[model samples]
Target: MAEGQRALIVSAHPEPTSFQAALRAAAVEELAAQGFAVQVSDLCAMDFKATLGPEDFNDPRDTTRLNVSLEQRHAWQQGTLAPDVAIELDHLLAADLLLLMFPLWWFGPPAILKGWIDRVFVSGAVYGRTAVFEKGRLQGKRALLAVSTGAPSQSYGPHALNGDMNDILMPLHRGVLGFTGMTVLPPYVAYHVPYVGPAGRAALLSSWRHHLRALEHLPALPMPRLSDHPDALGAGERAH
Candidate 1:
């Protein structure tokens, strides 16, 4: 990641008036007010393509096709990327913290954000297949997930039809971000988004402000398995 107090906010909703837009706007504003540099990438506005190509599967360096797509090469010379996946990676690398805000769709993040990961979180870059204990380049950064959901929190409890919110998020935090060594802070979620009317939204905005303002004082993301296997954390825990 680049050195600086910067955050990258990714919004994947197709409509600007949708609940996601409002939440994303509120997050960026609050973070900005807290004196952090903020960048917003509205995936819909970018018409981001989520599909990976024939070449992405084969690491360009090792393959004859050179994994680098013509589009990526073109963007490289033009000094601009047409969502080649690396652009987001660059921002992720540069930011001190990554604040992901999205609407939960089909029990998880929307397609474009998932697509962003598919394209950018390349195998070699994020991890290694054989060396399960390898370190991630993003080790020192922090990550937080904020989401807006139509389902009421009441509907998500164990007593309710759906499972806990954490159930839906475990794969993301534990399997992905935490697996990569970026400290995964507790998430922020706004439920019943469709019903979180103007007044409720105002309240959420106030809370969001506090979340952003508290970043500096908050403890860094803990090294995974710090206590369960304290010695196993070895070098990575020290970075935190």
Candidate 2:
């Protein structure tokens, strides 16, 4: 049992009655049962700001210019980020496991969740020079995505019309989560959710519960390590 461990569930769905919400609830209950203290961020219910803008930084490093990345690093270091961003950052840093629950839209996450990444994953706090991939600030943490898709399961298969689901999710898994040094667990996806009958929905929930029970043993998806590409480090330095 992971007693005293913390889990953060960030749920993005406009409707509280949606399957995404149900998944979030199930995660909370199961994590709690596993002796984890769970924290929830219901973005829609909270009316979370879905944009990254100047307001996110109270003290800009340059008054005449607005470089989002540089400003994020500055705000993070100065402890002057917007309250909502700061609060979420705290939860993120404190979590042992982070679960992002949302419906797949346009082959990606919703705009709100993207905004959360933009605002909370500050440049300095989450990643910076030499602090990325295996050396990321979140290196010891784990992240999982619980997603619901409108398309049927077969459509997401390797040669299906819609393309492989893993490929579709590679950007997020590798670019965002893995880039920050979090171990990316294989995502849990419920396909054709809108068309699934009640029995199917129940079965998905049951499977999700089972998956959560074995979270600790789940194998991480492959991610690139900076050490493997020593040349990349100099390239990274040049880019910055």
Candidate 3:
């Protein structure tokens, strides 16, 4: 809520005129009104690469094999990561609040958004042997998922066939964002987006605006803390 505080919204929808775009616009307007500087990364419009490969690194730790984790660390250390990735990483590091916006595909975020994480979240800079959970580089930041789903909200309920939405998103909440030490907020999900009428869409936008306005007070989702599990750091080191 402080002046000059920054918010970055990374949007992954392909269509520029889609409902998701509207949601993003609403967020921008609301956040700006609240005295926060807002930055947007419209992945689809940018034609963001959705795959990580040799090109992502200028200097690889191992030339014979592509070890993504090691290469990411090396590139991060050497400042040799791909240009696009570096730019996104800069934005990510500067943001006080990170909002991942996308339409759910196959019960998860779209491939582009996933790839954004893969490239921008450098292993050494974002997370490392000792820098996980509470000690992560992004520890002071906050992250929230703004997702759109094709199915109705009922289908994603506690006892619904598709399983609870919270359960479906646990990996991202606890593993990716939280793993980097970011405080994860409960997701803002717009269900049955395509099936909803104009009024419903408007209502969704209103709700999103309300959510953004109250972001400072939103409770963080539960996540693992290093102090609670002393062996977790050792386990990570062993895996590496």
Using lDDT, give the best candidate's number. 2
- Against the reference, the lDDT scores of all candidates come to 0.69, 0.92, 0.90
Candidate 1 runs further than 4 Å off:
1-3, 55-83, 130-134, 217-240
The lDDT of model 3 is 0.90
Best TM-score among the predictions, by candidate number: 2
TM-score ranking, best first: 2, 3, 1
- Enumerate clash totals for all models, in the order shown: 4, 0, 0
Q: After superposition, how far is residue 128 of candidate 2 from its true place, in Å?
A: 1.0
**Collision count of model 3:** 0
TM-score of 1: 0.77
What candidate 2 gets wrong by more than 4 Å, as runs, is 233-240
Error of 1 at 82 (Å): 8.4
1 versus 3: better lDDT goes to: 3
Taking the tens digit of each residue's C-alpha lDDT, what string does model 3 give over 1-240?
558889999999999999999999998898888887899999999999999999787778888889888899888888889999999999999999999998999988899999999889999888887788988899899999999998999998788989999999998999899999999998999999989999999999999988888888999998888888877655444353
lDDT of 2 by residue, 8-39 (tens): 99989999999988888899899999999999
TM-score of the candidate numbered 3? Answer: 0.95
| lDDT (Cα, 0-100) at 166 in candidate 2 | 93
Question: lDDT by residue for model 1 over 1-240, one digit each (tens)?
Answer: 133478888778888787677778777777776666888878888987787775443323334453443434444445444345667777777777787778898889888888887666655555443222226656777888888788888888666778888778877787778776687787788888678789887787677667766776666544454335545534642231
